[model samples]
Target chain A: EAGVTQSPTHLIKTRGQQATLRCSPISGHTSVYWYQQALGLGLQFLLWYDEGEERNRGNFPPRFSGRQFPNYSSELNVNALELEDSALYLCASSLGSGNVETQYFGPGTRLLVL
Target chain B: SQQGEEDPQALSIQEGENATMNCSYKTSINNLQWYRQNSGRGLVHLILIRSNEREKHSGRLRVTLDTSKKSSSLLITASRAADTASYFCATETWNTGNQFYFGTGTSLTVIP
Candidate 1:
């Protein structure tokens, strides 16, 4: 089966602009997760969507938000982007909403905020 | 803000050698996982060890979890040049079932 997929391989935006990253889960998967890997912050979970609902989120601010579609696909939107917001955004998909399942990731979308 | 730390930020070794990396977390967890990322691409799940389990192996990879110490270690034996990549450890807490907190990661470079 095909693995998770992400779009807009790379994105460039200004400080005040907004950037939207997209992710498509693997077939038969119902959980989608978003993570940000900044230069110094390492990899951190940004949001988690299970069965089309926002199940959990990280310590990020309101500017970082996302939603899951009926097909289990997800979209991550970062509003009022700041220079520090620039980083690699990754999307992962799992078979179910359970915590025991292994998550498969997609090629991250590199966002550069100038 | 909820994250762990991986020891030996970087490691460089020749082929046929063994590579070991350690991860330490602060909270109680249901399970701990290890992942590998090549370049800056997506991460691939390497192995996972549940809190109840002590050690698990997959081919050349062996993962051990010490729930008491809240630590985990990944050992790759007979490492090859193709194994060069960044390895990360993730922990899933009971409070946030769906959220997985990742560690800083260890970058390994295997010389051919």
Candidate 2:
């Protein structure tokens, strides 16, 4: 089975610009999660989407938002990007909230903000 | 901060030896999982131990959980150079809605 897949393996944006990262969950998965892995900040949860609803989000600012489509795909949008926004954004998916013990991750989209 | 913290920020060991890493989290969790990432890439799920469970093993990887201490440990036995990577512990808290927080990671280097 194909694992979670993400688009734009690498992205480059300038300060104050906006960036969009996409993720396609594995087949039959209903929950999609977004995370940011900065150099030293570790892996911080960004957003959680299950069944087309935004269940929860992390401590990130409002400028960081995302949505899940009907097909269980997700899109993460970072507005007013700053240099600090540069990091590898990872996407993961699971069966659902009831079976989230295991999450399969995508290769991640490396966003570099200049 | 629900993020977990891993001990021994880095470790270096020779191949065929054993490598152990520990993680401590802040809140109570439903389950804790271990993941491996090679060169800052996508993470590969290694093992998951439920709050009610104490230990689990997968191939050469062994995991132990101490809910009372809110800590978990990952042991990779008979390591190989290819096993070199950053190991992380992720916690799925009880109250959180399907959110899993991760640690800074333990960088393990297996020397040949």
For every candidate, C-alpha RMSD to the true structure in Å: 1.0, 1.0
TM-score of each: 0.97, 0.97
TM-score of chain A of 2: 0.97
Query: What's the TM-score of chain A alone for every prediction?
Result: 0.96, 0.97
Tens digits of per-residue lDDT for model 1 on B30-94? 89999999988899999989989999999999999998899999999999999999999999888
Q: Per-residue lDDT of B1-112 in model 2, one digit per residue for the tens?
A: 7569998899999999999999999988989999999999999999999989999999999999999998999999999999999999999887786789899999999999
For DockQ, the strongest prediction is 1
Q: Write the per-residue lDDT of candidate 1 for residues A1-103, one digit (tens) a residue.
A: 8999999999999999989999999999999999999874468899999999998888899999999999999999999999999899999999876768788
Pairs of residues at least 3 apart in sequence or in different chains that clash in candidate 2? none
Candidate 2 residue A94 C-alpha distance from true site, Å: 0.6
DockQ of each: 0.76, 0.75
Consecutive 10-residue window with the lowest summed lDDT within model 2 chain B: B92-101
Worst 10 residues of 2 chain A by lDDT: A94-103
